[model samples]
Target: MKMLLTVEIPHEPFNSLVRGGKAGEIIGRILEAIKPEAVYFTEQDGMRCGVFLINVENPSDVPAFAEPFFLNFQANCKFRIVMSQEDLQKAGLEELGKKWA
Candidate 1:
């Protein structure tokens, strides 16, 4: 399934990493491991943040994706299932709506 991974990194440790010049190295390592379909870096809620689109073959794989941020940056991480246009078209929404309506 396609999943969106949002990570909000707290200022303290993140700042420390930046000051120590290790932030890029750490983040690079994590990104290399995941090889996300897409990734964006930005600020959220006044904190450093990263948004990643990735494919997760199984629910059990979530921890592997999350642990790097958790351990390195003490990040707040969230995951959500997402759909492409093709996936949305394939969903049986019409039948479900008719059944419920």
Candidate 2:
């Protein structure tokens, strides 16, 4: 399934990584591992943040995806299932609406 991964890095570790010049290397390694379909980095709530779109084949794979951020940056990570337009269209909403209505 398609998932959106959001990572928020706390100030202390993030600043440390930036000062040590290891931020890019760490992020690069993560990107290489996940191979996300899309990724964007920005600030959120005044902290470093990343948004990634990826495919997760199994629920058990979440730990692998999340652990690096936790161990390296003490990041707060969240994942949400997402669907493309074609996937949404297949949800049978019309039938559900009729049944409920």
Best candidate, TM-score: 1
Clashing pairs in 1: none
Write model 1 residue lDDT over 48-93, tens digit each, in one string.
8999999999999999999999999999999999999999989999
lDDT value, candidate 1, whole model: 0.96
The lDDT, on a scale of 0 to 1, for candidate 2 is 0.94
TM-score of predicted structure 2:
0.96
Worst 10 residues of 2 by lDDT: 9-18
lDDT of 1 at 6: 100
lDDT of 2 by residue, 24-76 (tens): 99999999998899999999999989999989999999998999999999999
- How does residue 50 of candidate 2 score in lDDT? 97
Which residues of candidate 2, in runs, are more than 4 Å off? none
Provide the lDDT at 19 for model 2: 99
Number of the top-ranking candidate, with lDDT as the measure: 1
lDDT (Cα, 0-100) at 78 in candidate 1: 99
